[model samples]
Target: MKQLISYAVAALSLVATQAAAAPVTYYIQSEPYETVSNFTACPLGGCTVKYAKSNRISGSITLVAPLGSNLTDEDIDLQIHSFSISDGQNTYTDAQFFVDVFAQSARVSTDSAGNLTSFEFKFDKTHGTPYGEASYADSKAKVSYIWISSAPSPGAAVAASNSTCQFRGDNVNGNTNGAGCMMAYDTDSQGASSASTTGVTMSLTPPPAPTPVPTLSEWAMILLGVLLTGAAALNLHRRRQTA
Candidate 1:
């Protein structure tokens, strides 16, 4: 009877250990940049030209958990987001705009299991000017320089044109997480007082299961069962000797 009890206790201990070994899961979200604008200008016929600035550039980022992906605060990272410039009527240089994460009130949240659950960013409309320049010349006339301004006065403007979010960690192969963990500006030019937005999605794939650790209770129960079995065998041996 003692031996049977010992075996039953051992089985119960094993079951408890397995019950505590369930896998962990995580989810995360990212902020959206849906408001952006700037201005540009060009020269025509050796005369100064002016252009009206239009604000119509913005975007968002979404991260998805890959088949075997796991995310931790220490392993996640991001880079400055920027945008390029183009005049529907002229040419311009691609400029790098820095995102003000703090000003935009950007934040990332996670679940109790340490999984990223949500992310968001709020953009503020600050006043500012957009400017560009181009040279002009009449047929066979001496080349002259021309400058154009998008706004009458320069003011505070949204800092970033392109943006990127980088998730670095083990098992993250390049381009394997759907969109490769990086997102940038999707427009060609900066304008004034308008909203243009784009979005990218990424996933966090968890790696293989980790090695299990036996809990203290499990160890105690195992030890008790072994001791009980030994004691029972010793009693049985004594009874046989007497018989």
Candidate 2:
């Protein structure tokens, strides 16, 4: 009977550990977008140019991995949760854009200890932007907007003239055509704001660890109760024997 009880307790503990080790989702949130000030732009003829502006951008992405997985060695799926860009005069939300087809190469790099080091990806506004690219190499990440559109709504299809590329790291087999490095800057058609050449700091937040099922203390309490109940039954048996 004691052996059976021991086996049951061990099984429960193993189950708990396995449950706690299950994969988890993590969130990487972009700090509030910086406002690009003293910005200037010229139209086609270069005669009239817009001057001075401010803009704000915000968004977050999600990645998944085992609770203790080494992110540096993991090729995780990337999902963009929310994004927005504003020109101080006009604002746009993620609904107005889509992750480029090459987004599959979007990746995160981390130290061997699982600390994030850098991340990179490209996305385009729905109307006609070739690509909005960002790469993290140092303490800050730099972002560049190839082009932007004036579409006021989200979920709109990419314009026929729109072009984009996959990250160069994703251009497997030394193929460079249509790779991210080929992307070129273009004049914004609708005056959508562009991020400054300076870097934008981003923060990554991991999901809280799952609460262990039947914590060690709780298991001890459960074991104590079972032992007490068994003792009580044994005492009752002794009383009946005496009777």
**Full-model lDDT for every candidate:** 0.30, 0.37
Q: Write the per-residue lDDT of candidate 1 for residues 38-146, one digit (tens) a residue.
A: 3232222222222233321122222232112243222222321321222222222213122111112223445556444443332221111111111112122111110
Give each model a TM-score: 0.21, 0.38
**lDDT of each residue in 1-243, candidate 2, tens digit only:** 999999999999999887655544334222223333222332322212122323222234433333233544233333334444332333334454333322322445566566655544433322223323332211111122322211221111111112122232333322212323334232344222333223332355543444568989999999999999999999999999999
* Candidate No. with top lDDT: 2
Residue 133 error, candidate 1, Å: 29
Whole-model alpha-carbon lDDT for candidate 2: 0.37
- Give the Cα error of residue 201 in candidate 1, in Å: 18
Which ranges in model 2 have alpha carbons more than 4 Å from their true place?
Answer: 1-55, 66-105, 126-182, 189-192, 197-243
